[model samples]
Every structure is written in structure tokens, then in C-alpha cells.
Target: MSFDIVERSLNDGTPVELYTFTRSAQVFRYTSADEDVLYQGATFTAVPLSRPSFEQSQDPGRKPISLKASSGLGFVQQYIASPPTDSISLIIRRFHTEDNTTEAVISWMGRVTNVKFESNQVEIQCEPIFTSMKRPGLRRLYQTTCPHLLYGPECKFSKPTFQLDAAVNITGGTTLTAASIGGEADGFYTGGMVEWTNAGVIDKRFILTHTGSGITINLPFEGMVNGDSVRIFPGCDHVLSTCVDKFSNEVNYGGFPFIPTKNPFSGTPIF
Candidate 1:
């Protein structure tokens, strides 16, 4: 595939305009109105071109030159010495492929003095660029109909123990936050915590621990959420905080180093 220059113009007599094809390839020819021209193939190899060098070539009353090249895989020839302020005309030719496909070629023409050949190709330099992270859609199983546990003073320490079962397949680091539905007032209970145990392990010691005080969970790489169930041991009273209060720490509540809420029925305490 290649592109060709189909038209040319001048803007404010400073920058020369060359309209080239966006797709395919073709050859472009340039003709001068005045002065004889000598042609030469660039001796340099593929050196990159820079934008700054072209800006310095804007001068009035200088020798005018033109360039021509084949549309696809063709040589570029440069002309030297013509009318200083004269505009050049060009003709573009497209080549056809063996598969009956026609391709347009693109060519860039600037003042011969403005053109620079570092090696054979134009060189480009750029600064570092930044990108944003992409997140996947939330996974749903069992039609989102699972029951939730509520932790608050109203339930006291006499309520029945609640259980939660969740299975998550983690490809990278992930976080999971869960809370009670609506047994107590909104944001009335302390967030729950997670204690993880590897599958098939006989020991009861948790492998990883996470706090639910913020109702937010963060899982690191190689993280697994198998058929895990959180068993809330009853006979324990607790409190929850609002999303805002949890972040700002506005109140002077001193519930740290969790203390078990007193049982209303048994008059005993569980932590």
C-alpha cells in the first residue's frame, strides 16, 4: 500500500502545501516555470526528517527547486536552481498491482534547502506518554439473590449466626467489599473482616487477613477466592460506620481492638 501527492498550494507564501494520498502509492512529478534544473539522487541513506529544519527554509527570493518520485518503491529525484518566488506544478501517477489493485502514492515536497537527509529516512524524537487503567465488568453468579449479614446493636449478641459464600476467579490483584443488607440503621455497624484459609488445609490458622472497617477489600496477585464462606460468630455486638465517617474519622468513637457487644439474652459478652 502507498500514497501519492495529488495537489499542491502555498499558504501566506510561507509554508508549501502538498496534498498526498492517504492510502496506496503513486509517483509525483514537479515542473518549474523558470530556470533550468539539474537532478541528483540523494547520496545519504534512510535518515529521519525533523520538523524544525523545514521551518528555517522560509525565505523570499531564493532558488526554486522541485522533486519527483515513483508511486511505489521508487527513487526520489531533486531539482536545483529555478525562479526564486515561482510556484511549481506536479503530476501524480498511480501504479496497478498484479492482483488488479490500484494504489496511490504520497510524496512530500519542501524547499530543497529545507530538506535534510540524516541517513536516508526521517528521524523522529518524542517524550514519554501516559495511559489510564482499564477495568473489567463485575462478575455475577446465582442471579445476585444471595442473603447478606447485618451487624449492628439492634441484632445484639443473641441473633443467629449468618454465613456468606462467594467464589471469585482472580486473574490479577482484586478487591472485594461486603456488608449487611438492612437489619439495622444504615451505616450502623462496624465493617467486617476476612480471614483466609487455603483450600484443603487442615489447620484453622488463616493464611491472609483483611479488615472490613471501610467495606473495601484489596486482593493482591495470585489471589484466590474459592468456595469461601464467612461465618459470623454470634454472641458478639458491633457497630458499623457510614462511608463518609469511615473515611474522615469525624467521631471520637474508641472501638479499636474490638470489644464484644454484651448479649441481651444471656447477659454475657462475646468478641
Candidate 2:
């Protein structure tokens, strides 16, 4: 007797296509290359909402499903350690022999709301893409528009001129001193992206501000350790000056630098 479980395409010798998706960068959408990082062999479970006894007129809509899978060997550590922001999409395809054709079937397609990784397994909680549009609660007051540094419709700034990677030395306890990031230094790390290659996720972010060949940078709570592998991207304060100096795109500056700080509702300036 053959005991080997097989995942065969319904259409005779056809193949089944499986896809899992997650954002490569915290701010950017997934790219073709990001597809290379999707989790493998993820099992999906969708549960139907049970009807309430008291309500007869209302129909029990389809509820969100649960997807459980193992973090790929490359992404296990970061998936467990960092806060949840990674979004996931799952889709399955199978061929139908009777129809003489292949069709796509998706289990879950949405952002990851929660993730529990343990014992070499990862459990993910997700909602449909449309779920975010359903705002059942109150909205908050808008103070300012936070635009993406580059390539956002609001910002429209150009990409960075350079990319930097650094090795952390044991010297800087937690503050990330000058000596720790090699002999070379620059203040560009402030507002930059901090990514550790070994880390499966992105969480070592910071709004760095420093001195003496050191740029102050936002880092993880524990900061960097000896020989920690890290990469730094140039960050901007989003000012007219920085825009002109760094990216050379002052005309594309998003913020209103000339806007008065004093509240207009509170009357004119003291001067």
C-alpha cells in the first residue's frame, strides 16, 4: 500500500501553483523579487460564522480565516522577535481534468494582523483586503501628513544616491557610538532605514541624530551588539534644505516649510 501523501493537480498530470506574499520593506509594497521569500507549505483554515439564535433577518457573513505555517529557515528569527507589520497573501491553483483547464483558488489574501512563531512553526492571523475599508469605529483628528521619503505620490522625491552597510563593533554599548560603525561616518543615518541581514524582519529602525562623525540614529531597544551585521540607508528630515542638498529635488519637497508655526485660530504673532 502506498502511504505517501501526494499534492496532485486535479487535471491528470497538471501542476498546482501556490503563492505566499509578504512586504519586503515596511513602507513599500511587495515586488517580484519579494515572491522569492514567500513561506512554503502553509496550511489555511477558513471558518464560517455561526448564526445567532436571536437574529433571524441578518445573514452570518463569512468570517476571517486562520493560516498556520512555518517560518522559512531564512525568516524564522525575525518573524518571532519583531512586532507585527508583515502582510501576507495566500493563493492556490489546481487544474480540473473534466474541464480540460486550470483555474486559480485563493485561501487568504490580506495583511497579517498577528503572528505566533514557535517550535519551528508560524501561526498567522489575517483579514481580507477589504476588511481595512470597513471602519466600524471612530476616526482620529488629522494633524499632519506623513509622506513617504521617496517615490510616494505626496512626496515625489527621487531615490537615494547611495546605500551603506556597516559592521557594529563591541565598543558602543547601546547608543551606537562612532567607533562601532567602522572608521568612516556620516550623519545620513538619521531618518534612515536600519536593516540587519540576519534578522528575518525589519524593526531596527530609528530617527538617528548624532555628533562627531556619528549621526544620531533610532535603533532597537537593546541596540546593536558586537559584530552585528547591519545596513544603513540615507534618511531625510524632510526639510527644504535637506531635500535640496541630499536628493537635489527641492521643487519636489512635500512639506510647507513657510507655514507659520503660530496657530491661526489663536490670533497673530506677538511681534
User: Whose lDDT is greatest here?
Assistant: 2
lDDT of 2 at 2: 13
Summarize candidate 1's per-residue lDDT along 116-187 as a digit string, tens digits.
233444222211111112333553232212112323342232223333333333323334334432333333
Candidate 2, residues 1-35, lDDT tens digits: the string is 11111224332342223434455542222112212
| Model 1 poorest 10 in a row by lDDT | 123-132
Residue 234 Cα positional deviation in candidate 1, in Å, after optimal superposition: 11
lDDT of 1: 0.27
Off by over 4 Å in 1: 1-160, 169-172, 177-190, 199-215, 218-271
Off by over 4 Å in 2: 1-63, 68-77, 84-86, 92-104, 117-123, 131-154, 170-187, 196-204, 211-230, 260-271
List lDDT for all candidates, in order.
0.27, 0.46
